[model samples]
Target: MARAGLTAKYRPQTFGEIIGQDFIKKILSRASQQDSPASAYLFSGTRGVGKTTTARIMAKAINCLNGPGLEPCNQCSSCQQITRGVFPDVMEIDGASHTGVDNVRRLREDAVYVPMSGRYKVIIIDEAHMLSTAAFNALLKTLEEPPRHCVFIMATTAPEKFPATVVSRCQHYVFKMVGLEELTAHLQQVLEKEGLEYDSEAVRLVAARGAGSVRDSMSILGQVMALGGDRLDSGSVREVLGLAGHEVYSAFFQSILDRDLVEIHKGISLVLEQGLDIGFFLQEFASCWRNLFLISQCGQAAREILDLPLEEFEFWLEMSGKMPAPRIHAGWQMVIEEQKNILRSHEPSLSLELLFFNLAYLPDLLPVEQVQIKSSESKKTSVQAGRAEKKSPAPARKLKDQPKKTSGPENRESVPAKDLDWAGFIEFCRKSPDADESLIRMLGNCTGRKQDQTLVLICGQDFIFDSIQKNGRRKIISRLAEEYFGPGLRVEFVSNGSKSNSAFRDEAMNHPVVQKIIKDFDARVLEIKKVQDRPGFPGNE
Candidate 1:
């Protein structure tokens, strides 16, 4: 009298009708055709990947009166009985309801009987993972020594819950989730069969929302069709499913690009008011950032990866030009890392608001490349100013005694001792093949000063000071310092909060590179320390 739901009405009757899992279908079909079916089969996968459906088909294929064949001939009375779930030889048990040992004992007792009219008696257990441990133990003996005329098919979403003993007695077949393209094509075919007019994007949205579950997609499509009538569009799908549309994401990205906190707040308020699914919204937001990043980096070639509609691809491509790659990359990272926190927070809406505000202000902190460029530009300006201020050429005075050479290869040129400072040392370290990039980056946070013949490096953090003081790192620093400032020049590290004058701290903070680092990292000077050279250190001695 009433039409069946799409999932039941269009359920696959044969292996060829199933949408995915080509390999498993081939193996099972061959086994059925050859009449060598396993005594027990364990089908496991996520819901709606057709585990239970496949089990029913296997029963029909085995019991078909025509012959033991690769596919069930639905024309036969045995196949029709199994299809209608009225077959006397086929028993479908719900594992959730029959979880006790007593139920399992009854099943074992009944399994001993031979088929009344078919070649074998088929017992299908759905949600087998829900069975109790005792029940599994009870079923173990029957599964291990099943009757020659009986077949046991157990389907479960979570196979991990089954005992190893029970699993070892059966042939396990793992079902894979349906791919996005396959799922979309299936939904389109279903709509065509129903004679419903639908947009391609609407069908895709339903499939994406299903997330590899055919039953879930069918259910969603049914609901959308009920409200959407015969015509299904992307707008109706988004409205019915409580999903934000492309325009919402586009406006949000524009707010981020314009650095407008007010517009961002408005966009968030609209999303909350629309009652959009927060988890799915975050997922889509992350996808948008990913698309922007790819488009920014790969340009037109990104279309191949994105696989979006021409209009949508062009929109993102234009937006990508407005945002820098580094900013897009940073935004992508922030959204991905904060998704869990936002969903877990007591006030998810508030957490989401904070996230958008953070993205809006991301430009205030310049990217690493921009910071390095500004630092280099300042250094060049300072060098040019010094050159312009020089009145005459200074005479080079010959040294009475040549500096002692350190042991190394003949081609290794000695570093000049004049004008050796922290900035110059950092530049030299960048060029040196022996210097570790991590150590060089760590040294970027330190300020240096000359205390007579010793160079004292001031660290704002205790961890940095401790890290530089390790024997291996200490030796490397000492060797580099010796090469730069000449041999026998002692180097000492002072941690934060050490005694130092305000004048020295002020000068250190004002240094070009230090100023750039402070701006880029949003760091403040905790305390500047002046180190007193010790007399008994390795180089000091």
Candidate 2:
């Protein structure tokens, strides 16, 4: 027979063999030592964190023939049978496959019988959250008042799926993911026992890839060892796992710092060509920015928090010195904010390329305070230029009918109402504090012309015409128009159909307010319908 895989072959058979979850181990061990196991237990956590493994170990601890103790002796028949999964009194059920009221009823019938070869009949259910609502209901009474000889242990990756009624009847223990340091130590022990020579960095990479799951780490180690033979290195692990190396990230960052688009494009293309996992690649890229931010802000003290290799730490320290702390912080925030978008995009390659482009130009993006200062300086210069122009003589060749110019809002009142066209009216509304933003946006999709005392607004779409025709909105528009174009001015919306439906759609879509709403809400325009005036409905006069 083929040898069992590393995860199964090296499975922890005793509480001492488990790597993490110190609190859980203590409680379960004490319970077994006193022969007072709870009638039902709920073990919940992420996969590969030893929920099922702990449940099995608890079974053996309870069934050991030597005595009810803190740990099971592997030599006894009962312990050996439980370990081999053959003990008549110790049953392991797959909750996913046995998720029905009928199956639960059968289990209830079996629970009443006395143990054939052990002190208590242990029923261990793996993935217990998969059980149907009816199945859970059927087992509720059994859990609340189980037979003296019965013990139920449920292990699930998602305990939130379990009903509160079921959870309340059991001893709930949450298993935590194994810490990086502890997981690394565990892998080192496994490698030592296998007599394999491995680089410490390689081991750490494997542990990090596992992401706090002991079994996952062991599985990754197994795959690495199979291809790497008797020795292991970081390069081999990176290649095998399709992970980008430190050099790639360093070169990428260098391109960003230099603002070299060609080099940035080449680096991203190389990553895509190598078929690296984009999610993990982005994760590592984000980590680099985080490291830069930390190093720049905290100086050498960041080394302890980073826990990076000596060479890697120095490289980041050097890179951090070249970039300002604010830029580093901005880059970090940008990466974090856009990571989900990049991952969810249909064209992740293009999204990633755009992100790199933004990073390359990060220095050019000024802070809010600096922009405000520059704006104020520009206004002062313009004011001085205006004063200089006023002191100079007017051009002799000026047209007789040329309109006079105004410099600011204070001079706006000097301009004649007849000279205020549609564009001028819109600009005035924008500067007016009383104008409603929604009304301003609706007005943008309209073409206005003055005929006698009436100002007719030719709406590009039916919706715009309908919206402005409302009594409340029309009154506000009329009031604003009268204020801008002089008193007694009237406002009316007309759907002249001068533009085609497609033209109207395009104009509506291109409007600044419409575009802003679409981008801000991630929305799309489904359809635009024209509203026909109903009989007796208020019409534009």
Candidate 3:
């Protein structure tokens, strides 16, 4: 005979039958064994972890024909009726549907009556958090002081949603998620009893997909068993769940670790070609990185943290050794920071590609220690060069002895403005406290020459010239020139011709957008050229 569905077939009838949550079992067992059981109980945990089931078991344990005991005799009429959900004394109410005060009021009225055929009247409310505020207040009086014959048990996935007053009136029991090992063992038992042929790999996959929900795991296992004929394997499980195998994530992590762009491209393409959800793939990949991180930090103990099959765990352990903690952290951080953009993007495939592109280049970023060492080396080199200059005094003496020669652009200098290195002067302005970044940038891009005693500034474009000439900038520039080149020096401004497209190219390179592109793409603007004659084609001319 085909076995009944595992969930219903193996539903725990007694505390002993429950798979996980030993602590809850102990509490309930002790309470039932007591002569005066708590009137109200609050059971809180994630879904499918036996919250509601425990409520029913509690109901039976108290009213068992064998008398109040830790174990319910299922053969007893009260136990059988409660199990069938047709018992008169045992009432199961769904808080989601009866959220109004009227529903609670009706329940309150009904709860006053004594047990019809059993020793105690049991009222169980599922999803108790869904009760409206008014409903909870209505139930409070009945919950706090129900008749001696009645008991109230409330089961909810979220205890936090309940008001403090409501929670304070009841004894609370917290249920924990079923462990992966326990869940896997449970599935194995079910498959064996059903006489189904199965691979351990398939069982592991179903357990993971269950995510601590026994009901969900049974559902997944049932589906896989039904579709996979008599035999279940990892391939069937992955196909049914529409999930990429561990190999895919392994390939991705390896590619990123190796900084191999080509391999990364191939891996991502393979993922896309398989029609996996990009968002889900990213989340899974991040989980893999997290696993690797744990492994690197925790060593062999990482097995406890990562609930993967032995093969997958071994692979992760191997990978964990290959990638250092910092690089893994950096990579994982990038994935996390970009998650919002990737999900909101219209083209997730392209986004994934770009994300991997960045991951592939992570090795190019220097670690802090390396950067500090390089900086120290550069400083040492500069110091050595300075000492070498000091050791060679002959050139300096010979230069000082030579007559100061003046040739082209002579009159511009008291220090000829031409002889004044414009680049050096711009650097000085950059270091100056009074000169802001904008002014320094503007000066850096400008070409300077001498016209009599005036320093004539030729800007690359009209816009640059206009910007600098705003406010009292002309006066500021003149004052700066006088300070640098002496009392008679003055400043004049002019713009390059509009037809000169190369106009301001040097200064324009400093624009924020251009700078961002250079920084993000590791690129630069080598040359800026414009057509000298717009009216004629270059080739024909």
Give all candidate RMSDs, comma-separated.
Answer: 13.9, 16.2, 18.9
C-alpha lDDT score of every prediction, in listed order: 0.79, 0.79, 0.74
Deviation from native of the Cα of residue 298 in model 1, angstroms: 2.3
Give me the overall lDDT of model 2.
0.79
Candidate 2 vs candidate 3: the TM-score winner is: 2
Question: lDDT per residue, candidate 3, 27-75, as tens digits?
Answer: 8888887846788999999999999999999888888999678889899
Q: What does the lDDT come to for candidate 1?
A: 0.79
Q: Sort all candidates by TM-score, best to worst.
A: 2, 1, 3
Of candidates 3 and 1, the better by lDDT: 1
Q: What TM value does model 2 have?
A: 0.69
Q: Give lDDT: candidate 2, residue 122.
A: 95
Model 1: CA > 4 A from native:
1-4, 363-541
Residue 463's lDDT within candidate 2 is 47
